[model samples]
Target: MSANEVFLVAMLIIFSLPWLVWRLCRTDYFAPLVVVQIVMGILLGPGVLGRWFPDYHAWVFAPPVVQALNGLALWAVMLFVMIAGTELDLGQAWRHRRESGITAGLALGVPLLLGCAAAGVLLHLPGWVGEAAQGWQFVLGIGMACAVTALPILILLMEKLQLLRQPLGQRILRYASLDDIAVWGLLALILMDWNRVGRQALFLAGFALAAWGFRRLMVRLPEADRWHVALIWLALCGFTADWAGLHYMVGAFLAGAVLEAAWFDQARLDQLRHHVLLVLMPVFFLSTGLRTGWSVGGGEVFAAAALLLGATVAGKLLGVHLAGRVLGWPACEAPIIGWLLQTKALIMIIFANILLDRQIITSASFTALLLMAVASTMLTTPMVAPRLANRRAP
Candidate 1:
C-alpha cells in the first residue's frame, strides 16, 4: 500500500475502533468514549497489537505513518491543554480562597507524598527510572503524576453526572483549577534543565513581557480575532519553551492560563473544546498508546500500576475527608467529592508523556502510569454515581 493509504488505514483504526467499542458495548456508564479511546490506544499499541500481529502492526504503523500521526497529536494536545488552561477560574478560586487553598493543598499534597513513597520503592528496582532522571526527579515526577486531577476530564464527568452547574460541582471545579496550576508548576520544575537554565530564565522574562502586551491587545480586539491571535500565541510559546528546554506543553498551558476566560464567548469556547475532542484528540490517544511498552515485564508493570492506583485513590479520599472535617461538611459529601476529584485521564497521561519524552521515566514506568490513569478515570463515574444516587434517594 502507498504511505498515504497506510496512514489513512491507521487513522481509520484510531477513530472507528474506539467508537465501535464505546457505542456498541454501552460502556458509557462505566467508561466514557474518551476513556475507551485511551484503552483502545493501549490495546492497539506495541505491547498488545504488535505482540499479537507483528507484521500487520508494522505495516500499518510504519515510520512515515507514525510520524504524521505524531505531528497531529502534538498540535491536538497543545490546543486541548490551552483550552483547559483558558477555562481555569482562578478568580473563583480566590473568592473561595480559604476553602480552595485547604482542599487543593491536601488533594494534591497527600497523594504526592504517598506516590513519592511508591516511587521510592520502584527506585530500588531496575527498569523503572529513566536513564536521564536523577532519583529525586523520578520520585517527584511519579508523585505528582499520582496527585494530578484531570480538570478537563473532571468537568466532563460532572457534566455527564448532571452536576456541572450545581454548587457542589462548582466547588469541585475551584479545587481542581488550583491543583491544575500546581501540577503544571511542578512539571516545569521537573523539566528544568540546569544546563539550559540561562535560556529558560530568558524565556520566562520574555514571556512575561510578551504576555502583558498580548493581554492588552486581546481585550481591544474582536473575539473573532482573539481566537486567531491565541493560536499564534500558542505556537510562539510552544516553540520558545521547547527551545528553552522546558517542554512545549508547559508553554501551551501558560499561553492559555494568562488569557481571561471571559474574553471569549463561553458557548463558542465549549464548542471548540468539544470539536477538538471529537476530531483531534483521538490521534493523540493513539500516539500515546504507541509509546506504551512492557520492557520491564508485563507483570512488573501491572504491579506498579496497581501500586500507584491504590496510593492515588486512598490519598485523594483521605485528603478530601480531612478537608470535610475541617470545613464541617456532611459525611456523605467527602466520598463523592473525593471520587470525582480522582479522575485522571488526559492530564495524567499528558504528564507521564512529558516525563517519558524527557526520559525522566522509562516506557515501563509510563505504561504503569498509563494503566493507573485509565483505572482512576474508569473508577470515577462508578464510584460517584452510587453515592450521588443514594444522597438523592430521599
Candidate 2:
C-alpha cells in the first residue's frame, strides 16, 4: 500500500480503537476516552507493537506516515495549548488575591520541592537523566512536572463532577490559573539556550511590541474577524519562538496569553476547546505514545512511575492541607481540594514532551513521567466522586 493509505489505516486505528474501548467498556466513570487513547498510544508504540509485531508495526508506521502524523499532532497540540492559555483567568485570580496566592503557592511549591528531591535521587541512577541536561535542569524539570495541575483536564473533571461553575470550582480555577503561568515560566527558564541568548532576548522584545499592537488591533476589529487574526498570530508567534530557540509550543502559549479571553464569547470559546479535544488532541496523544520507551527496563520504569506518582499525590495533599490550615478552612475541605488539584493529564505530558525534545530528560525518564501522568489522571474521577457525593449529602 502507498504511504498515504497506510497513514489512513494508522489514523483509523488511532481514532477507532480507543473510542470503541471507551464506549464498549463504559470506562468513562474511571478513565475518560482521552486517557484511554493515551494508553492505546503506548500499546501501539515501538516498545509494545514493534517489539511484538515488528513487521506490521513498521509497515503501518513507515517514515513518511509517521512524519505526517507528527505534523498533524504538532499543530493540534499547539492549538490546544494556545486555547489553554487563553482560558487563563489571571484577572479573576488577582481579584481574589489572598486566597488564590496562598493556595497556588503551596500547591505548586510543595510538589516542586518533593519532586526535586525525587529527581535528585533519580540522577544517581542509570538512564534517568538526559545526556544534555545539567543536574539542576533535570531536577527542576521533573519537579515542575510533579507540581503541574493539568488545568484543561482539571476543568473537564470538574465539569463531570458538577463543580465547574460553583464557588469551589472557581476558587480552584484561580489557583490552577496562577500555577499555569508559573509552570510555563519555569519551562522557558529550563529550555533557555545560552548560545541563543541574544536571539531569545530579541524575540522577547519583539513579542512585547507585537503583543501591544495585536491587543490594540484586536479591540478595533469585529469579533468575527478576530478568530482569523488570532490563528495568524498563533502561527507567527510559534515560528518566531522556534526560530529564537524557545519551542513553538511556548510561542503558542504566549500567542494566547497576550490576548484577552473576554474579547471572545465564552460559549464559543468553550465549544472550540471541546472540538479541539474531540478531534485533534487524540493525534497528539498518539504521537506522545510513540515516544514512550522502557529502555531502562519495564520494572524500573514502572518503579519510577510509582515513586513520582507518590511524590506528586503526597505533595499535593500536604500542600493543600497546609493552605487549608493557614487560611483556617473547614478541615473536611482539604482532602477534596487536594485530590482535585492532584489531577495531571495533558499539561504535564506536554511539559514532559518539551523536556524530552530539548533532551533535558531521557526517554526512560519520559516514559516514567508519562505513566505517572496517566495513573494520576485516571485516579481523579474515582477519587473525587465519593467526596463530591458526600459534600452533596446535606
Which RMSD values do the candidates have, in order? 0.7, 0.8
- How would you encode candidate 2's per-residue C-alpha lDDT over 53-166 as one tens digit per residue? 999998988889889989999999999889999989998999989999999999999999999999998999989998899999999999999999998899999999999999
> TM-score for model 2?
0.99
Candidate 2 — what's its lDDT?
0.93
Q: What is residue 56's positional error in candidate 1, in angstroms?
A: 0.3
Q: Which number leads on lDDT?
A: 1
- Model 2 spans with C-alpha error above 4 angstroms: none
lDDT of 1: 0.96
